[model samples]
Target: MEPVFEFPLSLDKHGPQTLARRLHQQLRAAIVEQRLAAGTPLPSTRRVAQAYGVARNTVIAAYDLLMAEGFIVTRPGAAAEVADLAQWRQMAPRTRTRTRTRTRPAPPPAIDWRKAQSSEKPIGSAATAASARGFHLGLPDHRWFAADVWRRLLLHSSSFALPDAFGYPSAAGRPLLRAAIARWVAYTRAVVCTEQDVVVTSGAQQAFDLLARVLVAPGHTKVAIEDPGYPPLRAALLAAGAQLLPAPVDEYGLIVDTLPADVRIVCVTPSHQFPTGVAMSLARRQALLDFARRTGAVIIEDDYDGEFRYGSDPLDALQTLDREARVIYVGTFSKIMFPSLRVGYVVAPPWLIGALAAAKQCADNGGNVALQEALARFILDGHLAKHTRAMRKRYASRRDALLGVVERELGEWLIAVPPSAGIHLYARYRDRRQAKRIATLAAHHAAGAQPAGDFLLDRQTTFDSGIAFGFGYIDEAEIEGSIGRFASALRGSYASAD
Candidate 1:
C-alpha cells in the first residue's frame, strides 16, 4: 500500500479570501518552509477534493496555479510532486513570522576572501563613458566595426546542421578557429605556431588566469612581473598563490637585470608596455630570452595593442626571437576589434599546450563556439586585416591631433613620451606632485585620464609622475577642445599650488 498524501492546510469559510486562493497561499508557504519537502508527491485531485470537502474544479484550479508558479510539477499518469524550492526558498519573504523556533546555523565560507587582495578595474571597462569626449584607455572606435558582416557570420554559424555544433564544444577549442588564429598571428605578429599550439580563451584576462592556475604552484612559485604593469595579470597571479617580484621598467621596456634570479616566471608586455607606451629594445628582448634559457623561467609576452603603429616598421616580437620554446605568446582581438567581443588566444610551446587546454576546460569548458566559428571566418576571409588597416589610419589621425594640441597648450607642464606604436601616449609631469592634482582637476573639465602612480605596486616607490592619454575613445574633431579643457585645468591647479 502506498503512503497517503496529506494537506496540513486550513481554509477559513467566512474569510473574504477565496478558498482556492487560501489553499494556494498555504501550500506555497508549506513548500517555501520545507514542510512539503522537495519531490514529495501530492494526493490525486479527487482525493484532495473529497478529503478537504472542496469542489473538484477548485482543487484542479489550485493545482494548476501551483504548477504554473513552478511550486509543483506533474506529468501524464504521475502524481504532482513538489518542485525543488532551494532558489524559491532564498526569495521567500523574510518578514513573515516563523511558526518554528529552531534555526539552522550558516555554513562557513570555502575561501577566506577577507585576506585576499581586491583586483583593480581593468582598462577599457569604462565602455559606457567611451562616447564622452575624454581620454579613455584601451577602447577601440566601435563605429568602424563591421557589425553587419559579423551579424551575418554569426547567423550562418548558428544554423549549422552538424550535431557537434550544438553540443559542448571541445575544451581545446574548435579546430577551425585555432587554425585561423595560428595563421593570423604568424602573418601579423610573426609568432611561429600551429593549430596544435593555440588555446582559445574568453579574453586576455582569462588567458592569464588559466596560465596562473597551470603554472603557479600556490605560495611556492616566484613570478617576476613588470612594476606598474597590467593589474588584471597581477590579480590573476596573486590569486593563484604566486609570490610576485616587482621588476622595474625603463624606456626600452622591462629591466631584465632587475628580475630576481629565483623567479620561475616573467610576465611582460614587450611589444608595447602598458601605461608607459614604450616598445622593448631588441637587445633587452634578447637578454630576457637568454635569462629565461639560463634560469628555466617561462616568459609571457602580451602583445595587446601591437597592431597599431605610427612610425617605421615595428621590431620583431619577442615570441619570434624565442628559440628555446620558453615564451608563451598571448594576444587579443579586443584592441583591434571591440572589447566586448571578449576573444583572445594563447600560442604556447608543445609542452605547455596540454596543461593550458586542461586549465581552460576547468575554467569555462571553452569559449563560445558560434563566436569562435564567426571569428574564424572573419579572419580567413580577410575581414580582420582590412578592418585593422582602416582603424590604424583613423587612430593615427587622432594620435597626431592629441600630440599637436598637448605641445601647443600644455608644453610648460607636460613632456610627451614618444611612442613608436600603440593607441595611447604617455606624458610626464614637470612637477611630480602635480600629476594627481592635475588629473583630478582635468576630470571636472571632461578631460579624463589616469595618474601613472595608480599603476605602481608600491605607492611609496620613487618613480616619474605621469599621465596616459588614450586617443582611441576621442575623435579627431574632439581632441583639441578636450586637451584645451585639460590645459585650463592645469593652469588652475598650478595657480592654486603657488
Candidate 2:
C-alpha cells in the first residue's frame, strides 16, 4: 500500500478545543488552499488516527464532517478522496491584505478603428438567454438530432493512428476530411471542386475573415454586400478595413445592376436571404455570376442554411454556374447539425486556395482534427443526409404551424411573405405601429424576435418593418400558444385595422 501523505498540523493536546474539531479545521484549510490537491486519495481513518496520535473515532468524525461539507467524497468499499474545490473557492471570502496596497496598471494606448463598422446597439446582449418560447433566428431543431450516433462517431474518430491526428493538423485540413467535404458539397450543393480546392474553416464566418485577409487591401478595397443582409458578414468585412458598399435587395433577391463596378468582392446569401427569407431568382443568380466575371471581382456565396429546403428543387450553387472561377462557395454545418460544431468549409479557385490556407495557418494554426474526422465519417456513412431529411420534414411542419396561426388569427395585423424553403419566415405588418405592438407582446411572453429594420445598413433607407419567425427551434405544438400570447399582449395596445 502507498504511504499516507503527511500534512503539517500543530494540535494542542491541552487546548480547549476537541481533537476532532481541530483536525477538521486543519484538513479543510489544507484542501481550500490546495495544499492537498483535488482528487487525492485520503488515508484510511485508522491509519490517519495512528499517524496523528489520535483515536480512530476522532479521525472518523472529522472525515464525516468534511464529507458533509463537500470537502471530500467517500465510497462504500473504496478509499475516501478529496472533492473538487472549485465551488468551495467561490464560496470562500477573500483574504484581507492590509499590509500591501495594490496599484492599477496604466491604460492601453488609444486605437482609432476608423468608421468601418456600426456603433449601434448589439442585436443580442451577452446576458440574453435562449428562452424556450423565443423565436431564435437561424437556429435548428436540436431535439431531432441523434446524440448517441454523434457520441459514438466522436469516440471512434479519436484514435491517433493517423499522423495528422497525432500532431498539429494541416492548415488546409485533414486530407480525408477535405476529400469527404468535396464529395459532400458536390453531391448536395452542386458545387464543383476537388480536395485540393477545399479549405476547412472554423465556420463560414472564419472563411469570410480569411478571404478578407487574402483579398482585401484595407482602405483601397471596396466590397459590395446585400443591404438588410447577414449582419455578421457585413461587420466582419468592415472590420477588415474594406470600404463597404450596401446594395439593395428586392423580392427576387440582390439587384445585380446596383453593384459598384470598382468593388473587389461581393458577398451574398442567394439560396435564402437572411432576415427576409427570399431566394434569388435563377436569372438573378446568372446575372450575379456574369457581373462577377465582368467586373473581375470575387463572389462570396454563403450557403449557411441551404440544406433544409421545404418544397422546391435545390438550385445550382453559384460555384456550379461559374465557368470563370469567380465564386468562392462557403458552407457550414451550424444550421443543419448545430452551431457549436464550428465546422465550415470554403471551396476556392485553384490559385487562391494556397494563400487562403496559409492565412488560416497564421490565424488559428488549424481546427480540431478529431471533430472534423468524426464529421467526415458522419457524412460518408450517410448519417448527415438522413438527419437532414428528417429535420426538413419537422421544420416544414413548424413553418406551417406558425403560418396557420398568422393567417387564421392575426391576418389583419400581419402579412407573411410565403417562404418556399429555409427555417425562418418573414412577416410585414400594415405599419411600424402594428409591428412594435406585436414585438412588445412577444417580449412580454419571453418569446423574443428580431425586427427587419435591425439588418438595414442605413435605417433612413426605405424598407418594410417586419418580424422574422425562425420556426426551427420552437416546437410545432407550442407555436399556437405563443401566437395566442402575442394576440393577448396586442389586446388594447392597438385597434384592429378594420
Candidate 3:
C-alpha cells in the first residue's frame, strides 16, 4: 500500500500545534501541485492513527476541512481525488452583470421562422459554476472507462508524436484519428466520410461556436433554435451577435413546416432531442433536409449520444441521408468517453472544414495531442466499442433506478418520460406552477431550481415546462431521494407561483 501522510500529535492540539498545522500546509501544497490528486486513496482513519500516534478523529477533521473548502472529493469506498484544478481555474469570479432590462422585448409574431437549433440561452449567463465539481449536465461517469489501455497508448505515442504534433498539429486534426472517426461514424451513424470530412473540435460546443463564427453574419443573419432548448447554444449564437429565433419542438422534433425561409444553418439534435428525450421522426428529418436544400441552408447535425438506444432500430442520422451535402455532422466522445475527453468531431460538407480549422488554429491552438492519439488508438484497438457497451448497460441500470425512484416518491405527482437515449431525463409537472416555486426555493433547501421559463421565448405556450435531471452523474442511492426532494420542492413552489 502507498504511504499516506497523516496528522501528528503536536498538530492536533487546538492551541499552537505546529506539527498539525505543518501537516495541513504540506497536504494543501501537495494538492495544489497535484501530488495528491482528486480521488487518491488516502490512509484509513485507523491507519492514520497507527502511523502518527495521533487520534483517528484528528485525521478525519483535517480531511473534512479540505473537503468543505472544495479541495477533495470522498466516496464511500473510493479514495479521494485531487480536486479538479482545471475546474477550479474556471470557477474564479468574473464581473457580475445584473439584468438591466426590466423585461424582454415584445418579439414579433411568427418570429421563429429564421432559426435552426435548440436548447440555448440568449446570452452566456456568466458560466458561473464551472469550477465547482459534481455538475449535473451532460456529464457521464468516467469511472467505468478503460483508462489503462489509453494511458499506455498515450505514453507510447508521446515519444514519437512530438515533431509532427507538438509544434503545429494539423488543423484537420491527426489523420489517424480522423480516419478512425470516419469509420466509427459510417458504422454507427451511417454517414459516409473520408478523413477530410472530419474536423476535430474541443467538443460540440466549439463546433457550434465555430459554425456561429463562420456562418452567421452577425446581426444580418437570424438563427433559430428549439424553444426550451440548450442554453449554451443560444449563448454562443448571441455571443456571435446573431439574431436568434427560438423554434418550437414537438413529438416530431423541430417543426420545419413552420421554419423561416432565410436561415443559413439549422442546428439540431434529431437522434435524441436535448432535455426532452424525444427522437425526431423520419418524416420530420426529410422535411428539414428538404427545406435546407430548397433554401440553400446548412443542416448542423449534433448526433450527441445517439448510440445508446434502448428500443427500436436506430434511425439513420440526417447526414447519413443528405444527398445535397448540406448536412454537417457533429459527434462527441465527451458523452461516451466522459466529459473531460473534450474531443468532438465535425463531419462537414467539403467546403466548410478549412475555414473552421483555421478558426480552431487561431482559437485554442489545437487540443491535447497526447489525449487525441490515445483516443485514436482506443477506437482503433476496439476499446471504444467495449467501453460503450459496458457504459450502456451501466447507464441503463441507472435509468431504471431513476425511474423506480421517481415512481416510488413522486408517483402521480411527477410524470417521468423515459429516455430513448442520453445522459438526462426530462419531466413536465402535473402542477408546474408548484414545481417552479419549489425550484425557486431550491437555494434555501440546498438544491438547484432552474425554471423552464429561461429556455422559452417568453411565450407561455412555447414552454412545455418541467424539470431537468442529469441522472447519470448521481449514484443510485440518491436518485429516489433527489426525486422526492424535487417533488417536495415542487409542492412548495406550487404555493409560490400562485
Q: Top model by TM-score, which number?
A: 1
Backbone atom clashes (below 3 Å) for every candidate: 0, 0, 27
| lDDT tens readout by residue for model 3, 326-363 | 99898898788766667888998888888988888887
Q: Whose TM-score is higher: candidate 2's or candidate 3's?
A: 2
* Candidate 3 worst ten-residue window by lDDT: 124-133
Stretches of candidate 2 off by over 4 Å are 1-133, 496-498
Q: How far is each candidate from the true structure, as Cα RMSD in Å?
A: 7.0, 7.3, 15.1
Models 1 onward score TM values of 0.81, 0.75, 0.69
The 0-to-1 C-alpha lDDT of every candidate, in the order given, reads 0.84, 0.81, 0.72
Whole-model alpha-carbon lDDT for candidate 3: 0.72
* Candidate number with greatest lDDT: 1
Ranking by TM-score: 1, 2, 3
Give the C-alpha miss distance for residue 400 in model 3, angstroms: 2.2
Task: Tell me which residue pairs clash in candidate 1.
Answer: none
